[model samples]
Target: MQYLFRLSAIYVRHRRLALAFFCLLQAQAAVAGDLFHTDNADLYSRAFAVVPAAISGDTQLKFGDTPPNLRLRNSLIIGTGAALVAVYGSNNWWQSGFGGGFDTTNEGWFGSGTKFGGADKLGHAYINYAGVRLLTPLFESAGNNRDDSLSLALWSSLGIYTAVEVVDGFSHNWKFSPQDAIANVSGAVLGVALETHPGLDAMFDFRIDYRRSPRSPKFDPFGDYSAQKYLFVVKADGFASLRENSFLRYFEIAAGYGTGGYDTGGNHQRSTYAGLSLNLSRLLADDAYGGHMHATAFQRGTDRLFDLVQFPTIGYARRSLD
Candidate 1:
């Protein structure tokens, strides 16, 4: 009886510590399992698997065949991409040409006519969407699950674009634009939505084309009206639910608009275009081409190559001066 009583006393004295130790074990197991499975599992398995293993000193747990420094690799990829954008794409913001004073005044809806009739806003949205979409696969390769990858990509794009806006605000030549910020957010949301439903990717695409304009204070791609055309393309292949037809599937419709002569003291001319476009991805889809035109390196290279050549389209123009 005395021995039993002593045993009970010991158990009571150590109860809290034992409970804490068990909880610690559970936490470690959960962390290990998440790390392991995120790097290895398929969609179905990732959704359902959460079994916690017992933590034994002799038990070895491996997080797939990934290097022990997977986090470092992810950081490097993100950092490199950010550095490139900051250095080349946004170098104008850091240059001494613009006065050093910050502009806190928000440019109501359309920024100081410098954005070339909302072309810059559309550019912002396109950047945000493309940034998130591009970063998502990198995040996934870096060990994040699909949901986490999408979240990270969205936040990362927002962060980069917000940083750009902050730099713009401080520049003497540019003021903060609420319209641009809204467009950026909208694009990020669209990117996340598309990523969650990849089937929708074929349905919508944001494309941009640029041409040199003779009337502009500076040759800025983002600000120059004479140089930018933003297109929202709807691919017919995206209508997979509406009975697949061979002829219609290879076509796309695009509506694009841009403006010029914003800074040149002339009337801001708007260019609206509507035209039939080819769905190169759908047209090239064949067993020989691996049917993954959207995901292949060859397809991406072709896209970049073709982007240099602006396709001809029929459009209407409003306002007189160029």
Candidate 2:
């Protein structure tokens, strides 16, 4: 009961922080527009139009518009905001017991112990993927070339993850994991690859889902894995050759992996699942309001809310307990 209460408090706090972050982004966008003397109406319109344009391959949907200064401005704003959150919002993981001196030891691939059954590693990858994809467009809007923006997004994501590891190296509770770093790099690479390839980007998405686990020791959402799963969803529209099949065009296939019983040595469980999902965004792309809502809602947030909320149509799971 105490753990549940603390977990709820942390969740609420994080939600508030997320809301504030969104507000900050909106404010930054407005300020950038004012500095460039760009009409606000045009900015908002273009923001809304970019989604459809990007999907339709319209020439007007160039990935850049603002000047270099604006790009730097937005980058600095976001970086600083993220740094603040990491330092302060991390429940003093950075400050508590800071005198441990950096240890150069490698914490094996599986994170010392199976505390979260490697779910945290998957969380890291998904976060890096989403971070790079989300920031790439912002960089482009700030007048960066598409390729350049992708590169920036990649490095920035990796850099942030690396910074966390560096901090962990100095902490007593956590040690650096090479596996986590690899996951971060892999995710960043995937994000860049998908962003550069329109067909693949449209066809596939990386997503994550979690449910509260009674077995979690602490209230830490990042570390809890009793009921967390990472997913790869294949969009139906990716099959351009099968466009005639309307039924197939509205459906997606998903594969997911998760683990449980990390805290128990011999009771660890590994699970894999295959499922069907609805392609909501593609299904509603023709509706102006729906398209705009889908694009804005998914793009502007770090979490892929739509994917997290959508339940799988039919799922089959296989589990192995060791």
Candidate 3:
């Protein structure tokens, strides 16, 4: 975690590294699957998945849902891995000029000195982190116990990224960076750890916030570092005691890092922030959801959405590090 914080101190220059990272926010709805047993889209999707189901049929999931046993031969697990490899190869790599004989690039520095302001390292981490969280539930939903699911997610996430790096080692446009590997490993481990432990999962979230860069002629959430903020948060609702504290429940501690002006010409700026962050999802999920606010399906989606993306909220203590 300390290493993660240190590396995060340098994300003002984040740009898109994978199409997967670009899809992560939307991936929540697809990947979370039957974990929450939510209604509407979730229910419809669940039914569609079972019309000729590869494994199981519709079922309600409880917060206390227990895993039965591990299932190694699962279609979802294998399909997800193959999809990642195929999408990565086709989207960012394996293109015309993107291929070449083995080569390397000495990418380094977690500051302004590195390519793309070293913020792309966070991109590496974010991809793997999102990968683990997205896949763990799929594994468990396929009948693997939590421990087995987490373990598979960790290894699969690492393997997928490592494979991408190996391809980059032979690519024409990019090179494999030890820095990226470090970030990838850090994210995979952290993802599994948080999923393995509920207390930690509730307390902290590694999330990225983004808006299209004004300099860009079109909206580009993937490559716009000027408007991207990577946030590490500790929510007050993590504690049962704090959860009962009405006023304190929606407040949280947020530490964030990002680069600005990178999207604008050469006028680069780096910033880091720490202070109170409002948990708007919690506000919507708990106190403000009419009366059926006890883990309703809407609350499930909101919680997952907030976990993956840091929605805009009023805050204080933001400061420029550069």
Q: How many angstroms is residue 261 displaced in model 2 relative to the true structure, after the best TM-score fit?
A: 3.0
Candidate 1's C-alpha lDDT?
A: 0.61
TM-score versus the correct structure, for each prediction: 0.67, 0.68, 0.70
Mind giving the per-residue lDDT tens digits that candidate 3 earns over 1-322?
9988867643311222343333322333332333333234433334434233343545544565533222223334644575655455545454533345667677875577666675677877887898788777767667666765676677667766776676677556677788888999998988987887888988999988887776866665555667777788999988889988979988988888887776568577777877577887777765667523336655765676788787777364667756
Cα lDDT tens digits, model 2, 32-125, are 3333332334443354343332444443445344442443445574566465646453554433333367665544444435556567778778
Q: Residue 105 CA error for candidate 1 (Å)?
A: 2.8
TM-score of 3: 0.70
Q: Which pairs clash in the backbone of model 3?
A: 12-258, 12-259
Native-referenced Cα lDDT, model 2: 0.62
After superposition on all C-alphas, the RMSD of every candidate to the true structure, in Å, is 17.7, 9.9, 11.9
Best TM-score goes to which candidate? 3
Clashes of each: 0, 0, 2
In model 2, which residue pairs have backbone atoms overlapping below 3 Å? none
* Per-model lDDT: 0.61, 0.62, 0.66
